[model samples]
Target: MKNIIYVVLAMLIFASCEKPNKIAFVNNGTLINDYQEKKDVEAKFQLKEEAFRKRADSISQAFQEEAQKGQTEAQRLARSNRKKAEALMTGLQQKQQQLQQQMQVEQQQLTQSFQSEIDSVIVNVKNFVHDYGKTNGYNYILGTSDAAATVMYGAEQSDLTQTILDALNADYKKE
Candidate 1:
């Protein structure tokens, strides 16, 4: 009977010694938004967007002035020279189309450039998170954002947002 009791006690101790799975969660919104590179890239893109808008506006204003001038000359010519005024108007329309096409091209290029850069930044952050989990012995790392939370309920102790963010910032500084 004493041996049976000892065996039961040993089994209980061994079971108690087993560690639970390591898991943690990071706030996705905080991680992405607070990241320095993301902010800097956004600022740079905003400046580029503003400059392009200004340039397009200037071109548009010049085209408007030319249209107004053409209108004035057409009015001065009367119905006898309607054909000449119509031809001038056609030429003005072509110029406006060209200006619009040019603006569209510029906007597309800027958007692609910004999107590619941001995508790369996001990939880097994801890799950092993966490595962090592997190095820290976490079985899984959950992400929570405003849109959705991979981890619906977790203890505050299981939150690793600050730790991951600090590691990420440190990694960025080295680069």
Candidate 2:
């Protein structure tokens, strides 16, 4: 019984005396805010959005012309033509809906692509940090998101955003 108590006390002391490992944090916001590749991706999406807008404008003009023709015809013929115009309008609406859906899918794909890029950047950053830590004799390194939970605040001066962004941009420039 005494030996058991002694053993428990020794374990507690050892646990209490353990030294904390070396740690560093990475901010996710830095990747979005400072990364040139992220800016390029956003620019690409904007161009796609503009193209969609132009297509929609042409569709709208065609619909308006057909609707105006129905408005100008005589009453008897107008009824038949109005029905046809309505059908055409319905088709146009469907086309518009389809275009909107396509745009949504494209937007989602763009978001996914950006997410993938961010993940790849994170992997590269992790590799660089691992190598840097080893070369500099750091025992452990930690990464924090934009919120910087473990580290409530880190100065922009200390932020490694530019370094990581430059590395990512350089790598992408090669490809």
Candidate 3:
């Protein structure tokens, strides 16, 4: 019984003497959304998206005008000849299909470009976080997410969102 007590006391003293690990956490959602570089990236992509939309709208307007002309001609032909009207209607539908396919191709291309750019940004953010931790002498820089309690309980003092954001923004300009 005395040996057990001595062993327990020695273990307690050893544990108490060990230095606590240097640790901090950043909210991943907050980090990405409020990141300055991310904002700039989004702005650039948004411009591209708007431009695409404008071009698409212009094409759609032209297609609509063509359809209206075809419709009017179809009405007149139908009154005179059913076979001619059917051919006109089929031709207009083919044109509509071609226009739709063109729009889809353009939209897909834009989407793919945006996705690749966004993915690159995400990778840079991860790299920055890793470098930040190493340079700051952090033993562990945990990440939390707004969608889930990745870190259910952390002291407010350990939250390093603003610090990382500041470093990220400053580095972004240099890049």
Candidate 4:
């Protein structure tokens, strides 16, 4: 019984002497926004959005011109053939509706694609941070943002946002 007590005491002392856990935190918003890959993705999507807008505008302008021409022709026909003019106006209206629908579908598709790419980049950043923590012997790595302060206060030395950002940017450049 005495030996058992001594053994338990020894184990407790040793456990108490063990090294403290390694913990760090990064600014979630900063890390994600400053990541090189994320910036690149945003730039790419911006260009695509601009191009889509230009194309949409061009299509709209051409359709407007066509509609103007059709209206003039319909007016001339109405002077002699009222039924034919009514049919031409109906056809033009249907064509405009179809064009608007097509443009809307195209815009929706582009938005979805852009959102998917952004989601992918966010996932990649999270995975990279996870790997970095594991590789660097971190027991815990917390993320904090202005919206949700999971880590309200941490020592300046414990803030790893810039370090992780640098490493992430370097890795991106390599890729």
Candidate 5:
């Protein structure tokens, strides 16, 4: 009976000595939005988009001028050769269609490229968080966003969004 009591006491002491699991939660939206690398990536893409828009505008203006000249020449030909004028108009229409298709393809490619870069940045941020959790001895780190709240109510003490953001920005500055 004394041995049993001693064993029970030892078990209780061991259990009490075990460390509790460390868990934390971060706001997903805030973490990503406030990341310095993400902001720089977005700014770089914005400049590219602006430059693309200017080039597209210039191409459109040049096409318009060419079309106007074609129309004038077609009208002049119509007085002497009606069939030739009709063929010229048809050629102009085909050219316009080709330009529109090319522009659409360019725009789609640009959008896809932008999305890919953004996705990569998001993955990097997630990886950083994962490493941070591991380094800080976190057993679990929940992510909550306004769009999808995985963590509905974490205590302020357990919220590591700002802390993680600051660390992430500092890491980015180093890079």
Candidate 6:
């Protein structure tokens, strides 16, 4: 009777020790910084901005040259041309405003997309980590990458940033 009671107590203790998994980490900053998809979007936005500036400069230079040529007829024509230039400048200003708005929208959308992609990958990795922890019987699994004090010392093997970035790029390539 004593032996049977001890055995049952041991079984109960073992059962109580078992649990499902919970995972936490600090991959958000790393995901935004290292993600290739986000980098490409930024590059395209820069190219568009540079092209817009060049076109605006060319228009302004043409207007200045016309103003510099001084004859009575030329002055009269310049006055008329100046009004036209002013109207065109207004239109160009409006276009620039529209382009800036478009760029903002694109930036917002790209941010949302990168977030969605990272969330999905995090979910998959969480599932994997849960399995890994359960199999290894780790009651607590911590991401040293998320540690404070400048991440003083973490094994490169444990960083997991490169691994996650690779997964991100692979998913991007598939798309």
Off by over 4 Å in 3: 1-17
For candidate 5, lDDT tens digit of each residue in 9-84? 9999999999999999999999998898888888988998899889989988998999999999999999999999
Candidate 2 local lDDT, 89-162, one digit each (tens): 56656866776687678668767876786676557656766776676555754556756566677666455556
| Weakest ten-residue segment in model 1 by summed lDDT | 71-80
Most accurate candidate by TM-score: 4
Q: Which ten residues in a row have the lowest lDDT in candidate 4?
A: 117-126
Task: State the local distance difference test value for candidate 3.
Answer: 0.89
Cα RMSD for candidates in order: 3.7, 5.5, 2.3, 2.2, 2.8, 7.7
- The Cα local distance difference test for each model comes to 0.90, 0.65, 0.89, 0.94, 0.93, 0.59
> How would you order the candidates by lDDT, starting with the best?
4, 5, 1, 3, 2, 6
Q: Which digits, one per residue and each the tens of the lDDT, describe model 4 over residues 1-175?
A: 9999999999999999999999999999999999989899899989988999999999999999999999999999999999999999999999999999998998899899989988998898899899999999999999999999999899999999999999999998999
The digit string of per-residue lDDT tens for model 3 on 1-175 reads 9999999999999999988899999998888888887788789989988998899899889989989999999999999998999999999999889989998998899889878877887898889999999998889999999788689889999999888988898888887
lDDT leader: 4
Clash pairs detected, candidate 6 = none
Which pairs of residues collide in model 3?
Answer: none
Report the C-alpha displacement of residue 100, candidate 1, in angstroms: 1.5
Q: Can you write out model 1's per-residue Cα lDDT over 1-175, one digit (the tens) per residue?
A: 9999999999999999999889899998899889888988999999999999999899899889999998888777657788888887788889889989999999999999999999998998899999999999999998999799777898999889888888898889898
What's the true lDDT of residue 83 in model 6? 70
lDDT tens digits, residue span 104-164, model 6: 6766766676567656656655565455556655564455444343455555554555655
Candidate 4's TM-score: 0.89
TM-score, candidate 5, is 0.88
